[model samples]
Every structure is written in structure tokens, then in C-alpha cells.
Target: MAVLETPGAAGEPEIEVQIRGLMLDPVTNMPIVVLKEVGSDVVLPIWVGVFEANAIALELEKTETPRPMTHDLLRNLAKGLNATVRKVVVSDLRADTFFASIWMEQGGETVVIDARPSDAIALALRWDCPIYVSSKVMRHTRQNNAETAANVGADDLKRWLENLNEDDTGQYKM
Candidate 1:
């Protein structure tokens, strides 16, 4: 299990989560990666770019391309260097953006690389490593959503996200 210690909330444990589904945002028609906390109903939806969404969806569906995708190349590179991906962490949420870190171990040293959450997640799937989200990120997401809801009357959006089901996600089209 991977855990991130929050600054103010010392000892705060990172929540392990898995990719619940990938779907299009109802309002914006953008891609969303839904991550559900392990053994819990808590979920987080992260909006991602179209290309990044395609990358994640391709991995999720196990679709094969003739040539290696960027993420596949990354996996090959890491393995070629004798580095093992320990885990990926959704580390923070700031200014409506999410941040992630890829933890890799080579020999006796561990390296943490800053990455976009979408890229980190795609790599996580390729590496078959654990995925975690900082508790602080979860808190911030809720607070931000609440504030946005109050300001823009987007409560329905929040409700939709919270109530997403398998049928609601459907299949992601490239």
C-alpha cells in the first residue's frame, strides 16, 4: 500500500483507489476518469484531455496498436533501465488541477517523478502497480466542487458524478 503524508494533517493516509470507469462529461463532453476508493463507495472524477483519455482508454480496454504508444515506450524505458514502478499517487489538487507522482525504484534508490494524473494513471495500468490518492486531494476536490456548485448552480453535475453507474459510463469512444 502506498501512503502520502499530508503537511498539516500529519499521518494522514493516502487512499488506495482503482479506475472505476472512463466516461464523457455530460456537460462538457470531455473525458473523465472515475476512481473509486478500494473497498469503499468514495469516488473521485478527474477531467482529462482527449489524447490522455484515449491513452487511458486504450490501456483499459487492452487495445493493441501497431506501434508502441507513449506510455508503452515509458514502460519499456523503465524496464530497460532496471527500474520498477512502485506506485503512482494523485498527490494534490490546486487551482482546479490535479497533480501526480510516479514512484520508481532502481537498484537501492527510489525516484519520484512529477506527472499529470492521467499520464501517471496510464503508466500505473501498464506497470500493474498500485494507485493512491492523497486524502487532502479528496478533501480539496469536495470543497472545490461544493464551492463551484454554490456559485454556478452545478449541484446537478455533482449529483450526476456521485451517482454514476456502469450504464452511465457506457463505452469510451476514441
Candidate 2:
């Protein structure tokens, strides 16, 4: 299920988004996690480090490793502690960087942990939790990579998804 939050009385609602794909940025040669809104054409591409992208991609592709990865360990730890990850929020974009928070609940108490968007996204995928992007951040992206989704048809998106290859994940070994 998807979760959206308004930070305060005047805050904009967070919009739920899903991972579209992980691919290497042609110009930067860095990995990027592409996210798309569930019922809209809005898309956000967050450039991430190579290894973290691999972690997200592995979960997206349902590839199991012989040993638990870092995200796996964190998920298992939360389970061991009886903490449920309610949602992962990509809450802000400042100084050319994105920020996120992981909302968790345990023993009738709720907690929010500051996290990098990449790491929080990986854990969210593993836990089968929803991912949200603040409207504020969405506004910022509208001037950047948002056109990728705004003008594409469903068939185009499907073809793009179908063409994703292992090589597109960059040089990281999963």
C-alpha cells in the first residue's frame, strides 16, 4: 500500500511513486534510480552511487543472494526488533541533493529516521513498503528530468522497461 504525509498543517501531500528502472546516466556515468508516480506521468530520477543502485535493482529484479546484503540486514534487524517500516519518504531537495526519512513503528510508538534517499528506497523495496515524494521535491524536478515521463505514452514506458539490461546497472557487481 502507498502512504502520503503532510509534514505539518500547511504542508503539501507526499505522492506515492514506484521504481521504474535503474540505469546508468550517460553523461555522468553514474547510476540513477528512476521513479514514476502510480497514476500520473510524473517521474523523478535520483542519481545514486553504483553499489546502492545495485541493491535497489537486485530487489526490483527479485534476485536472491546467498548472503544478505546491507538492505537485507537492516530489514531483518527491524523484524528482529519488531519495528515495522511504515513508509519511506523522499522529503526534500536542497543544494542539489535529495533527503529522505524512514518512518517506523514499534511498541505503539512511531519513529522517523533521517536517511539518504537511495538507502531508504532500497530498504523500502525489501520491506514491501511504499515510497513517497514530497510535492516540493516534485516541483523541483519539473524543471529537470520530469519531461521523461510527461510526454511518454504507456507503450513507450513499457518498451523502455522491457529494454532494461544488466549492463544498464553500471559496473557494479551484485
Candidate 3:
């Protein structure tokens, strides 16, 4: 559990993060969560899965599925227990793995459960909750961002942009 104070230690305003949009890795075809701060241009890329991204996109696009998804099942259980999701915290990053926790209140008892940042994010969108990343995870994301971006080809970028405009919503195969 990392505490991210609003007034950052260096006197810089803490970067406020929010879901930017959905994109697929041009190389691996894996789904990615686009995190960005409102009014700021810097974006953090976190790779997720096709199913998970679809779940998130449904919520973002405000489309309801005929049947409940896995994350939706979890949310339904939480609601049934009289629980409320507070936030999802991305607590650590090591060797390219990012860890997260879902903070929930059930019957007045607050519980934090370990989760993958990707899964945690999918649920966060459904619950309309905030997402936090420890400074370490943020730094790790930055390093991977550079490596992934540098290797992507010109044709991949052109195709990705077109897909975004068309709202095709399929994962881009690398």
C-alpha cells in the first residue's frame, strides 16, 4: 500500500491519472490500458488482455452485455454484500510486473485484495472508481513504454490510428 499525497515531495503537482482510451500493442496484439492525466499529454501504457479490454470498452461506450462478465460478477457480489469499491491501487512494479489491489468496504469492514493492475483496472471502470499507481509502477511503465514504442513500425501506427477512428475494437495482431 503506497500513499500518494497530492502535494508531491518535489513541489510538483501530483499527476492525476484517468483512463485515456483502449489500444492494442502493434507487436503482441495484446490489449492495453491508456492512462493519462486530464489536461496533460503524458500517457502511461499498461498491457492487458483482449477479453479484459473488451469488458472495459463496453463500460466506456456505455453498452450493456446480455450476460454478465467475470468482472461484472465480482461487482455484483460486492454489491450484494453491501460493499462499495473505493479505489484500485497499483501498489508495486518489479521486473515488468505491476501489482494492484482492490479496496472495498463490506458491511463496514474495509478489505484490500491483491490483483493484477490489468484486472483491477477492468473492475475499476465498472465501479466508477479511481486508480492509483505507486511511484515505482509509474517509473516501470515509463521504461517499458520507451522500449515498446521504439520497436513499433510505421505501418502499425498508421493502422492503429485508422482502427481508432473506425472503432473496429479488435486487438491489433503484432
Top model number, lDDT: 1
Tens digits of per-residue lDDT for model 2, 74-139: 999999999999988888888989999999999999888999999999999999998898877877
lDDT of candidate 1 over 1-174, digit per residue (tens): 334443212344688888888998887999999998888666789999999999999998889999999999999999999999988888888787999989899998989899999999999999999889888887887787788778778586577776877788875554
TM-scores, all models, native as reference: 0.87, 0.79, 0.73
- Ranked by lDDT, the better of candidates 1 and 2 is 1
State which candidate, 1 or 2, has the greater TM-score: 1
- Candidate 3, residue 158: how far the Cα is off, in Å: 16
Among these predicted structures, which one has the highest TM-score? 1
TM-score: the better of candidates 2 and 3: 2
In candidate 2, position 31 carries an lDDT of 84
Please state every model's RMSD to the true fold in angstroms: 3.0, 5.2, 5.6
Cα shift from native, residue 121, model 3 (Å)? 1.2
- Models ranked on lDDT: 1, 2, 3
Q: lDDT (0-100) at residue 140 of candidate 3?
A: 62
Measured by TM-score, how close is model 1 to the native structure? 0.87
At residue 124, what lDDT does model 3 achieve?
A: 90
Native-vs-model 1 lDDT? 0.84
